[model samples]
Target: MGQKTALGSLLKRIGNSNQGKVVPGWGATPVMAFVGAMLIIFLLIMLNIYNQSVLLQGFSVDWNGV
Candidate 1:
């Protein structure tokens, strides 16, 4: 019973300690900045592609009434 409670407290402390430490390499400021920039560019590209598709779709429709 005592050992079990002690083990639980040790596990809880380990979990809390993990939140304080930054991961090596990937946590560097420059790497993070580059990743952020790439993400923004990716989103912009995808948005542009979607907008182009939507714009072209309207042209493909045949309006017989017009």
Candidate 2:
């Protein structure tokens, strides 16, 4: 079909154009460090909240109320 031929030619042109391109962006190291720092902060906050909850609730369970 004509549509199929047009689509194939469009794809071929795009492939040829992008054959040796770098597509630049940030390298991995700094982005990874940022993500790692955020994860540590999140874990610390969660641990603090869990400790507070344990202190207030004293490990008691009321399963039947569920």
Candidate 3:
């Protein structure tokens, strides 16, 4: 092997077997979509808290005392 291809290079390459492979993941799940939607709601609640009752611009919710 060339000096440029050291053991560290070999180790790095070895762990990347799926680097270019199409892998089915979170985006393929309905549950993930639901969870993501809920996360957006949660984030919106927090944003309205930190930014004072406004979420996603113009979309506002009545957040009394927050």
| Cand. 2 Cα-lDDT | 0.74
Worst 10 residues of 1 by lDDT: 53-62
Which residue pairs show backbone clashes in model 1? none
The parts of candidate 1 lying over 4 Å away from their true place are 1-4, 16-27, 53-66
lDDT of 1 by residue, 1-66 (tens): 345688888988888887867776755788889999999999987777656643554443335746
Residue 9 of model 1, lDDT score: 88
Across 1-66, the per-residue lDDT of candidate 3 in tens digits comes to 546657878888898866888867755688888899999999988887667754466555567735
For the record, the alpha-carbon RMSD of candidate 2 to the native fold, in angstroms, is 5.9
- Rank by TM-score (best first): 1, 2, 3
lDDT of 2 by residue, 1-66 (tens): 345688888989988986877767765878899999999999987776656643545543446655
Winner on TM-score (1 vs 2): 1
Clashing pairs in 2: none
Instruction: Assess every candidate by TM-score.
Output: 0.46, 0.41, 0.38
Regarding lDDT, does 1 or 3 come out ahead?
A: 3
Q: Which stretches of candidate 2 lie over 4 Å from their true place?
A: 1-26, 53-66
Q: Is candidate 2 or candidate 3 better by lDDT?
A: 3
